[model samples]
Target: MFIAIVPAYNEEKRIVTVIEKLEGHVDRIVVIDDSSFDNTVSLARNAGAIVLEHTVNRGQGAALETGHAYARSVGAEFVLHFDGDDQMDPHDIAPALAYMKEKKAQALIGSRRLDEHSTVPWFKRHILLPIGKMINHFFVRERLSDVHNGFRILHKSVLDSIVIEQDKMAHATEIPAKIIAKKIAFVEFPVTFTYHEYGQGTLSGFTIIKDLLFSKFISK
Candidate 1:
């Protein structure tokens, strides 16, 4: 069966729409609420998602790890890692999933390069994108255009093989590195994205660099 794991933190305004749009696209939609202070859990449950709430505010990485683990325990054959911030376009779900199935790859990462209609910011396109690509290339040995995208599909084997220790955005960096170390077969699929203002900069560039360095080399 197909499962989508959405990690949310206090996202009440748009969770309903995200869940509503994903209907018929996935078998099960699991919202992993990272100790949200708002009504994220209740809203997700009411919107027809299986809500998994964390006791404390662990970061997105922790929430995603919990969601994927629960999905595996319940016998999910295919898993889609998504965001609850509504930055990812739900329209990409169907085609990306179909391509994943066709490729039979252990993991399929979403790249904005595939979507010609994607509108990215100047700083992200000029500075952050290049930095992320270089960092991911060093670890995965593949020059991926978008490395930290949360929109991706993973087989159970790929998810189970990689160990996620980063508790924040750094998990994005850690995951591909683990996949490369495990020698898992992965492919990149183009996906469109929408940048929500509130969700775009939870952490600054310096903070992101610190997290990436610690997760990629220093701490890990």
Candidate 2:
């Protein structure tokens, strides 16, 4: 069985649409509400997704870990981690899953480099990208065009082998490191990058830099 695991946090604006997009593509959908203050949980439940909520906001890592555990519990053969903000396009799911089965990979990452102009913020491309590349090259010893993208598909084995401890945004940077450390069989396929309406709020340029510094140097 295939399962979609969505880690959401106060994503009342776009979570429903994301779930709708996943319909018919997977066997079941699991929404891990990270203690969203809004009606995220109720919206997801109403949308026909199994909703699980954290008592308090434990962070993205915890949310994702929770989703993964639930997916495994249900005996999912392939599990996909999709963002609640609709940054990842649902169209890439079929091909990515096909590629995973063809390659027999333990984990599959949907890379966003294929897009001519990545929807990722400019600061992320200029600053965070470099820091991520440096960390991957030095610590992980692998070259990845997109390191922190939330769009990913993986086998239960990889999820079982690795554990995410960083209960924050840094989980994006840390997940690949753990995958590399374990020498898991993983592959990446180019996928589209487009942030949706949820990203309407303007983020200062420094915010990306600050998160990168914290995740790369301090949080680790």
Candidate 3:
């Protein structure tokens, strides 16, 4: 079965809309509420998602790992990792899945840079993302068009192969790094993003790097 896993943290305003957009796109919708204080769990349950709750606020990566474990438990054939915020375009889901099937790939990551129509902010488009991309390449030893895009689809086999140990934003790098290390067959599909003011700031990039280094250090 196809499943979409959304990791949400106090996203009451947009969780319902995100769930609504995903309704018919995937067979099942799983929302991992990372100890949200708001009505996120109630709202997601009302929106027809299988809601999973964390006792405390772990980071996005930990929430995703929780969702992954549940998906695997239920024998999910394919899994899509979607953000709880309304930034991702649900319309891109079908095309991305189709592309994955067409290429016979085990995984697919969304890339805004692949589409000329994608309107990325100037600083992110030119500077922040480039630095992130380089850092990911250095760690993962793989070159990808977009290293930090959260929209991704993975076959169940791929899911079984990699483990997400980074509990925070560093999983953005760690996921790809693990995938590359396992020699997973993957591709990048063009996807659109709607950047909001609440999005991660420039300083968050440094935080991600720090988390990544710490994760690597601990792994060693």
Best by TM-score: 3
Per-model TM against the reference = 0.91, 0.86, 0.96
Q: Where does candidate 3 stray beyond 4 Å?
A: none
Model 3, position 100: C-alpha lDDT score: 98
Query: Which of 1 and 3 is ahead in TM-score?
Result: 3
User: Which tens-of-lDDT digit does each residue in 84-200 have in candidate 3?
Assistant: 998999899999999999999999989988877567788888888898888888887888988688999999998899889889888888887888888888999999998765466
> Which runs in model 1 stand beyond 4 Å of their true positions?
198-203, 215-220
C-alpha positional error of residue 87 in candidate 2 after TM-score superposition, expressed in Å: 1.3
- In the range 1-220, model 2's lDDT, one tens digit per residue, is 9999999999999999999999998889999999999999999999999999999988887899998889778878888989888888888899999988899888888786755545767766666667666664654568887766788888889878887766766677667878888999888888887855434122422343355456666543
Work out candidate 1's RMSD over C-alphas: 2.1
Model 1, 1-220: lDDT tens digits are 8999999999999888889988899999999999999998999999999999899999998988998889779989888888887878878888887887788778888887766766777777777778767866765676676768788788988767776787887788778777777888888888877776634452554565687666546553
In order, what lDDT does every prediction score? 0.81, 0.80, 0.90
- Which structure among the candidates has the greatest lDDT? 3
Could you tell which candidate, 2 or 3, scores higher by TM-score?
Answer: 3
Better of 1 and 3 by lDDT: 3
